[model samples]
Structures are given as C-alpha cells and as structure tokens.
Target: MTGWTTANILSTLFGAALFPFMIAVAWGKMVEVFGAAGGWVAGFWIVGVSWLLNHGLGLHHQAGDVWIDMAMAAFVGLFVQSTLAGGKPGKAVPALISGVLGGLLGGLILSIMA
Candidate 1:
C-alpha cells in the first residue's frame, strides 16, 4: 500500500476545509466584476483557459495533481453561487459541491490518461 505522509494528509484535509471559502471569495469577485450571466461565462472561460494551458503547453506532468482543476472549480463554484444562490449564506453548499466535484472529475480524467 502507498504510505501517506503526515504533511500530505494534513494538507489534503486543510485544502478540503478551505475549499468552500475559496469558492465564496471567487464567487464574490466574479459577481462584483461581472453580472450573474457574466460570472457563468467567466467560470467556463477559466476552465477552458486552464485546460488549454495545461494540455496545449504541456505544463501538467503529474497524475491526479489538479491545482489548475481546483482553480477552475473555484471559478465555476463562484459562478453557480452568484447565479443560483445570489451569494446567500447557503450558497457555500452548492459552491463547495460544484468545486469539489469538478476538481475530482478533472483529476480522475488526468490520472487515467497519465
């Protein structure tokens, strides 16, 4: 079995816990800069740009390492929260769900290919 280091485990836990807050901040910024619809567009744009940079430029070499994916997810989560939840207190739920799911999906795909 693969042994997990304490730092790795701790970082993972911290990242998971902090994810929602990151999404919230991103959502707030997107909403502030652009309207609801624009936020959605920006979210998609972030994903697309990240993909192009990672694949087109051959930047990502590690499997299952999804820092870019997480950034995309954060943008998307913000978009969802701004559009559907309107930055309400409950918006964090959807934001977290979307961001985590999106990041996981991207990481899984990358891992499979790698």
Candidate 2:
C-alpha cells in the first residue's frame, strides 16, 4: 500500500478544481432549460456516461481518480446544493467544489494506501 500525503491530495484537488466550472459553463444551458432537479438528473447521467466512456474505455489515464472522487463529490454536492439553494440546485459550481475536495480527500487516502 502506498502512503497518503498532503501534497498529492492537494495536487488532485487543484487539478480537478477548474473542471466542474468548465463543465458547468458548457452544460449550463441544458441545466437551465431543464430546471434544477432536471438539470441534476441530466448532469448525473452525463457524468456516469462520461465516466464510463473515459474510464471504462480507458480513454485517458490522466483522470485516473476522477470517477470515484466525482461520484462522491456529486452526491454530496447535490445534497448540499439542494439544501442551500432552497429547493433549486446549482450543479456546476457546487459540484466542482465538492468534486475537487472529494477528489483530494480520495487521492490522499489512495496515495497513502496505494
């Protein structure tokens, strides 16, 4: 097992930090058209499908820990956003923050135990 470290965790977190924002920007229209809940539904599906395409298909290795971290972040973010948004959800910003934080935490653990 590898050891977890603060540096690696930070690396992962920072690396993924801007990803959610980009995703939000690109998909913002779809989300707005669908409404918050609908946006989440579509967003989650997109995330899942994209993960499968990228990870399952081995399209890229640079995003190695993305799936797990994003999943964790998305779920947690969804909950937090829904709560904070007062029924309406803001997917991109929250998801990005959540995903980055979650990814960093996951990377820390993985690096430590890997």
Candidate 3:
C-alpha cells in the first residue's frame, strides 16, 4: 500500500496473469527434457524444497531470492531426470550427489549475491 502506484498495480496484475503461462512453458520444457514423471517430480520438488529452504534457514526473502531457489530446482530436476532415465538403482547415488552439488552451488551464488 505504501508504495502502491498505478504502474505498479498494472505490472503486478500483468505479472500475475503471465505467471501461469510461464509455468506452463517451463512445465512443457521440463517434460521434454525429463519425460513426464521426472518432469512433474522436478517441478513440484523445486517448489517444496525452495519453500523449506527459505523458511527453515530463515533466509531473508527478497526479490532475487528465487534465482537461488530456481538454481537448486534445476539441479534437482536434472537428478530426477537422470535417475528416471536409467531406471537403475545404482543411479540414485549419482543423482543425489549431483543434486547436492547443484544445491551447494546455488547456495554459494546466493551468498555471493547477498
């Protein structure tokens, strides 16, 4: 309310409307990259993990916080994709390791940003 302005309001409204479209595009791309189950898992996992990290770590929420969250998400997505791709038990270790690495990288980037 304090910073409300016509331009801000309009932009917010536009962004809200565009958000779903963006999600759909992302979803499609994920599905293409990872196939159906992996894609869905990655998409949902990103949201869940991001929420947990943001709140659990007590990280300050800011406009660019999503960049780090998304980076982690991509790491998770790739892990899921590779795991599902092989459909092998042994792949789990590699997937987890890569995901953890991705998460570490994302955190590092976030720290640098801060």
* Highest TM-score against the true fold, candidate: 2
Per-residue alpha-carbon lDDT of candidate 3 for residues 17-71, written as tens digits (9 for 90 to 100): 3334334446667778889986778568645544454444433233442543334
The C-alpha RMSD of each candidate to the native structure, in angstroms, is 8.6, 10.5, 12.0
Candidate models: Cα lDDT each? 0.56, 0.55, 0.54
lDDT for model 3, please. Answer: 0.54
lDDT of model 3 at position 109:
98
TM-score, predicted candidate 3 vs. hidden true structure: 0.29
Error of model 2, residue 78, in angstroms: 18
TM-score of each: 0.33, 0.36, 0.29
Question: Clashes in candidate 1: how many?
Answer: 0
Relative to the true structure, candidate 3 has a C-alpha RMSD (angstroms) of 12.0
Task: List clash counts for every candidate, in order.
Answer: 0, 6, 0
Q: Relative to the unseen true structure, what is the C-alpha lDDT of residue 52 in candidate 1, on a scale of 0 to 100?
A: 57
Residue-wise lDDT of candidate 2 within 1-114, one digit each (tens)?
155466556654543443343354445666677778766875666666656544454332343453454444445544554466575455467866887898689789988995
Better of 1 and 3 by TM-score: 1
lDDT of 1 by residue, 1-114 (tens): 145666555544444334445546564578778889767975676445555544444433333543434444445555566667556656468867886898789779978996
